[model samples]
Every structure is written in C-alpha cells, then in structure tokens.
Target: MNNIVSMAWVKEHMGEPNVVIADCRFVLGKPDAGREAYEASHIPGAVYLDLEKDLSAPVDEHGGRHPLPDIFDLTVALSLAGIGNETKVVAYDDQGGAMASRLWWLLKYLGHEHVYVMDQGFAAWTSAGHPVTDEIAEPTPVKFLAIVEHTMLVEMDQVQELLGREGVTLIDSRETPRYRGEVEPIDRVAGHIPGAINRFWKDGLTVTGSWKVADEQAERFADLDKNRELIVYCGSGVTATPNVIALQEAGFTNVKLYAGSWSDWISYSENPVATGDEENA
Candidate 1:
C-alpha cells in the first residue's frame, strides 16, 4: 500500500468500521499545543496522539531526544485509540508531515502494515472547507498486538559499525547548514556523522507543500544507487522518517532508520563528527 493518502480519501473513508483517523499535530516546544488544537477543532471522529507522550519515550542521556516509545506502552495507546491489528490508520499533522511521519514510522516498526500519512495535513483539510468538530471522538477500545519489526531500526552502535561500509549509505536528513556543521541549534555538536551524505527531508515536498509523487521522489534521489542500503537520520530521529518514506516511494527497498540519530550519536564524546560537506573516511 502507498505510504501517503489524500484528504479526499480520508474523507471518503471516515467512520468506516476498520478505518481510524489520527490527529498528530505537535509543536516542538509546546507540549500541549497539539491536543489544544484538536480540542478546538479537528476532523470529525479523529483521535489525538501526542508526539512526546504517545509516540516517544522519556529522553535520557544516551537515547535521542525522542526515543522510541516502549512497545507495550505504545500498543496500549493504540488499543485505546481503537486501532486494532487490522485497523487502517491515517495520521496527519500541521508540521509538514514531520510529526505524523514519526507515528507512521513507529506503527510500521511495530509491524503494522496498514497505516498511512495524510497529504498536506490538517491545515489543508480545514482550509479546503472540510468538516471540523470540537467534540472529541470516543472510539471503541480494541487490542493492538505488536509483532515488532526489528530490522526497521538501527541503534547508535549499529550506525557506528556501518560507517564507511560499502553498499551502505547513511543519510543525514537535516537542512544543509546542520549537515555542514555551519550552525548548532538543538544539539551540542553541529557536524554530521562521518561518511554520511546530506538529503534534507523537506526536499521531498513540492513548492505547494504537498508530498511529491513517486516519480518526483525518484528524481530527487536519482544520483544514489537504489540497490544500496540507505540508513536515514535527523536531529532527534523525528524528521528522518519522511526521508525513509521518500526513499520507499523512490523504489528503494533496503532502508533503515537510525532511531538514536545525531543526538544519540553526539552523546558519546568519542564518536567522530564531520563538517563542511566532507564525507570523511
């Protein structure tokens, strides 16, 4: 199934027995903003999922700022959101799919294959004259068992081992400045992982802010070998997911996410960092 769905498709499938819409809007610094937006107005029958609470675990010294949520806890959250094993979930956010793609990646990592990210997000949905509701949805709770796709993730240690390895490509999905080590805003270290290439996640979108078509996505990464293993990462692992999805859309089958990402990479002072567009050996 395609990783992204359109607003019309979501609108068409609303209230279906097996279809669930999730409001995943989140502001990085404002913890409660997403829920507040949802409470103010959202797609009818949509359930809210917080990026920090439902999608990620508490931050620690080693793991990235947004560590993957505990599998058991995440499963329970999904169950409470009325997402069964067979449910078709559509996730959306106002942050250019950054927040929603995190949930999409998490669900896929948990072995759920029927999930998708909605295109253009909540703002487009609202601006296009779609129905919105202040009333919260009360979905019937159901069991959501996680099978766990371990192959989808790569830890910091695994990332270290893959450095400079042939047939493997580490992609830094942050902006050019961050990748080049020209500025350090969020993390202590500014440079990217040694031997990694830059592929800003936002480039996957069109000028109008919609996800690019598969052909367009393929064009975006035309220089890379599709057969090679592509491992993607961002500041805290949240933004890298869109690049993961973009790679999949571009017909790359072998892709993985470095869940700990740059934040975790920088935690160990011994880890080497590269700067200024140099893919250090």
Candidate 2:
C-alpha cells in the first residue's frame, strides 16, 4: 500500500472494524495546543496522539528534543488508542502531514505495514465536508505486540561513523536557513552535522501543501545516487519522517532515520558542525 491515502479513502474506511483513525496534530512549542484543538473538534472516531506526550520520550542530554519512545510503552499506547497489530491505521494532522507521518513511520518501524498518512490532513477533510465531532472516542483497547524493525533506525554513533564515508548520504531535513546555520530557533546549535546535505523536508510537498507525486519526489532527490544509503534527520526526529516516506515513494530502498538528529549531534561537544551551502560536501 502507498504511504499516503486520500480523504475519500479515510471517509470510506473510518468506521470499519479493523480500521483506526489517528489524529496527530501538534505544534512545535505549544505542547498543549494540539490536545486543545483535538478536543474542540476532530474526525469522528479519531483518537488523539500528542507529539510530545504519546509519540516521544522525555528529553535528556543526548536524545534530541523528541526522542523515539520506548518500544513496549509505545505499543501499549497504540493498543490503548485501539490500534492492534492487524489494524489498518490512517493518521491525519493539520500540520502538513508531519505529525501524521511521524506516526506512520513509527508504526512501520514497529513492523506494522498497514499504516498510512492521510493526504492534505484534517483541514482538507473539514473543507471537503467530512463529518467531525467533539465527543471523544471510547475505543476498546487491544493487545499490540511490537516486532521492531531494527534496520529502519540509525543511531548517533552509526551516523558519526558513516560521516564522509563513501556510498552513504546524510540528509538534514531542516529548512535552508537552519541548515546553513543562519537562524536556528529551536536547537542550541545553528549549523548541521558535518558532511550532511540539506534537503528541506517541506519540499516533498507541493506549493499548495499537498504531497507531490512519486515522480516529483524522485526529482527532488535526483542529485543523489539511489543505490547508496540515505540517512535523514531534522531538528529532533518529528519532521524527518516525511522525507523518509518521500524517499521510499521515490523508490529508494536503503533509507534510515537518524532519530537523535541535529539536537543530539550537538550534545557531544566534539561533534563537528558545518554551515553554509555545502550540497556537494
């Protein structure tokens, strides 16, 4: 199945016994704003998942701003949200699919293959006259046994080892300004990891904020060799999942996420940071 699904697909399958809808809206700074918005109104039967609370672990010195949650804990949370191993999940968010993609990636990493990000997100659903409700859903929790796909993840140490190595590509998913060390509003450090190329994750979407076609996504990464290893990261790990999906859509097989990302890279004082346009570096 494709990584993205349409609003029509979601509307059709929303209430099915094996179908689960997840509302994953979140803001970067305002942690509570997502839950508030979800309470105000959301897709009927959609269970809310906060980026910081449900999707990430508590921050520490090493694991970026939003670290990957513990495997067992994450599976339990998914089970509580009515997602089982066999459930077909469709996640939607108002933030241009970033939060939704995060959930999609997490599910895939946990060896769940039937998960997708709802295209164009919640606003598009509402604009298209889909039914929504403020009443929270009470889905029956089920057992979700996770079989982690260890190959989908790349640790900081692995990333450090692969820096400047042949047949490996590190993609920094931040915007050009942040990647160039011009302005970093989030992380302490401004520059990106040394030898990492910038591939602003938002570029995977069109000007109107919808995900581009597979060919278009392919064109965006045409400069890189598809056979080589591609490791993608953002400030933390929340935003990089979209690029991971995009790369997969573009037919890249050897792709992984540097979950700690730039925030964790700078945690070690000895790690090198690079600034300015270094696409070929």
Candidate 3:
C-alpha cells in the first residue's frame, strides 16, 4: 500500500480482515478529547488508539515528553487491535498527521511495510460523505512480530554528535515562533538545537490540509542529497512525525526521527540552544 490512502480507498477496504483502520486521533490539551470524539463517530471497523495510552509510555525527565512506548507493549496493543505482520494498516487523525503519522512511523519501525496514513485524516474521510459509526468492533487478537528498525530512531547523544556536522542535517518541525525562540508554549526552552533548521510541519500540507504533491514535497529538500542523513524533531517528538512522512514522500531514505526532540535536548542544562532566524549550524 502507498504511504497515503484516500477516503474512497479506505471505504472500499473497510472491515476486511487483512486491513485495519486505526483512528489515531488525539488532542494535546484535552488529552481524552480524541477518544471521546472517536466514540461519538468514527470510520466503520476503526480501532481508536490514544497517543498517551497506546502510542507513548510514561515520560521522564531524561526521556522528554511522549517517550516511545515499550516494544512489548506496542506489540501487544497492535496484536489486540488485530493488526499482524501482514495487515495493511490505515491510520488517520483530524489534526493532519500530527497524531496519525506517529502510528505510521511506529508501524514502519516495527517492520510493517503495509502501513499507510489516510491523507487529510478523519476530516477528509467525513467530508467525503463516507459512513461513520458509533459501534465499536472488537476483532480477535493476533500475534505481532516486532522486528525493530533501530536505524530509524536516534537518541540525544547521537543528535549532539551530529550537530554542525557536514554529512547530516537536523530539521526542526516546530512553528516559526518556537523555532526562532519568540514564544514557547510547551517546553521550558524557547530555542532550537544549535545546528537545526526550521521546517514547520504544516509546510508539508496543502491548503486543503492534505499532504502536498510528491514534487512539492521533494522541493522542500531539493538542495540536499537524498541519501544524506537527515534527523527530524519537534517540541516533544510527536509533531515531528509529519516531517518524517514528508521526508519519506520526498524520496529520502536515510531519515531518522529524534524521539526525545527539543524537550530532551533542553533537559540538560549544559546542552546548547540557539535562537534566531539565521542558520545556526
């Protein structure tokens, strides 16, 4: 399956045992809001997975916010949702791919190549006049074999080592204000890593809220060699996923996501921070 799926495609494949539509809806402020909304209305046979409960484990000072969930737990959750190694998973959320892309990335990390994100997310699904339901279908569980792709993830030390390095690029997926240190609403630090460049995650989306065309996405990183190592991060690692997807859609293969992101970088007082519109690296 392609990395992006449409509402029509999802509708056509709904309820198939080989397909799973995961409603990865989430609202950061109102943590339970996504689940409530999902309960109210969701795609038929769509299983709701919360960002807090299913996608992330308990965060600590060192792990930053939205730390990656335990591999065993994630495997169990996917298994309970009836997702297997062969399942073609379709994930979506209302807030672009802010929440949905995490699932997409997670599935890829677990060596599931048959995963896709519903382009434009649940809003596009509903806007297309597709069927939604309050009924929750519980499919029988199956074993999920987790083959971790360790190369796709990076820690703070590796990121630090790559700072200002010639062969790698660090892209910050936060908004312009946060990236420029103008305002920080979430983390204690208001700046970005010393060598990172700001690429707002929304830039990857079209005016209609769907992902940009392949050529448009490709143009974002046209100056860089596609094979060069690229690291993407945002405030808490969650928002950075859209950029990761954008990079993939752009045909870049050596992309890595900093799971801790800026929050983890700032957790240590000795770590450096840069503020301004200029290229810090």
Using lDDT, give the best candidate's number. Answer: 1
Model 2 lowest lDDT segment of ten: 272-281
Question: Residue 158's C-alpha lDDT in candidate 3?
Answer: 91
Candidate 3: give the clashing pairs. none
For candidate 2, the per-residue lDDT at 86 reads 95
RMSD of each: 1.2, 0.9, 1.1
Q: Which stretches of candidate 3 lie over 4 Å from their true place?
A: none
- Return whichever of 1 and 3 wins on TM-score: 1
lDDT, model 2? 0.92
Worst 10 residues of 1 by lDDT: 272-281
Pairs that collide, model 2: none
Ranking by lDDT: 1, 2, 3
- Cα lDDT tens digits for candidate 1, 101-193: 999999999899999999999999989999999999999999998999999999999988988889998999999999999998999999999
TM match of model 2 to true structure = 0.98
